[model samples]
Target: MTHPIPIFIGVDPRERAATNVLIDSLTQNSSVPLAITPMVTPQLEKQGLYWRDRDPKQATAFSFSRFLVPKLMGYQGWAIFMDCDMLARGDIAELWALRDDQHAVMCVQHMHEPNDTVKFLGEPQTPYPKKNWSSLMLLNCSRCRALTPEYINRATGLELHRFHWLAGDHEIGEIPGGWNHLVAVQDPAKAEESPLLHWTLGGPWFREQRTMGEGLAAEWFAARDDAFRLWD
Candidate 1:
């Protein structure tokens, strides 16, 4: 018998509602076999490796490094590490099939275009032109376990507030841009064709006044309702 392909989603428990919505969306829409893993940061006093204070951002990367990636290493299948805010536009199986190549990971390009600018550490900044996608990443489990610890250590050492610049060289160890499409900043015409839509500015919940541009906000609400059912 052929072993089932395994797809994994990671969530930090602190963002419970968002994470639940993400998992619900995948289960209800995805045709492939998948697993939702909540990546929790153990309290400093409780046990295991602690990455200094629980700075939410650092804690997130560290959880992937110290826990999630290693746990999946035992398996010989493909894995996708999705952020809680990523909502799938269609079947993600297209991405899974790309694993046939020996690439360690596949990601989208950073989407901020030439004219778009962001402020970083009080200075005007443009997106790092080189970093492959960071929002959604697909990794070979075996390869990830080998590099996760070092990635985590290096990521944690950087000042959390300055993440945009300190995010570091993606070419040193990340896949090409096509796999994880950073859709939010793409031109409106191009955005419509992307498979995954990442909420770059902030998550769905963060926009208290405006809804997510199109029908997506409604879709997110429906997914969130389904997620609540999982707990019940």
Candidate 2:
């Protein structure tokens, strides 16, 4: 039997436009059947309950806790979690193939040097070798559901006092780093060959065009109109 391979994307009501652009791009390039799941955080409903209220570094933690973990637990088979800012350039069959492995959680390494300027406003430089981008992740849902809760609990329980310790654990196991490309801070030379471009900082809508070297964005945008109509 062929297992289901679903593609998930998260979006808040505030980011509807970017979300639409992302979905349009994915539909255009995707050859396999895909599912888009929006990421919503409970903090958005409660005033003054923002990530900054707890740990500024944990800005994205609640979204993962409230939405991603639960969704993965319920989803059977393989799922690809693509950030709302990513544009797919080619067939994602390789990503689906990776999910067949029992011990792997597909992901990409962060291209920015450890001390690159994008670090949080008041956060200290990371002592670790470097960080990985969380923008695109492919997982065997069965394996992820087993560990998602534990990871979420650990991330949520970190003391607000230890601000620098708030980074999410991206090192699950032997997943490739090419799946998630960090466009802005990525090395231009390296990005030239990446399959997926993640508009981590600002996407095409805000910038009016692709800027982080030539990438799949143009093709993705070209196909958007038809793809969006079909997906809708």
The global C-alpha lDDT for each of the candidates, from Candidate 1 onward, is 0.50, 0.51
TM-score of 1: 0.67
Best by lDDT: 2
Clashing pairs in model 1, backbone N/Cα/C closer than 3 A: 107-180, 108-180
**What lDDT does candidate 1 reach at residue 153?**
44
Query: Judged by TM-score, which candidate is best?
Result: 1
Task: Tell me the lDDT of candidate 2.
Answer: 0.51
Model 2: number of backbone collisions: 3
Error of 1 at 143 (Å): 2.9
The digit string of per-residue lDDT tens for model 1 on 1-232 reads: 4344454555555456666666666666677666566555554224343344444433243333333443444634566666665666666666666663355555654545445353212223334444325456665555444343334444533321222322243422444343344434445455556566655443455445136535555656766766676552
Clash totals for all candidate models: 2, 3
In Å, residue 180's CA in model 2 sits off its true spot by 1.9
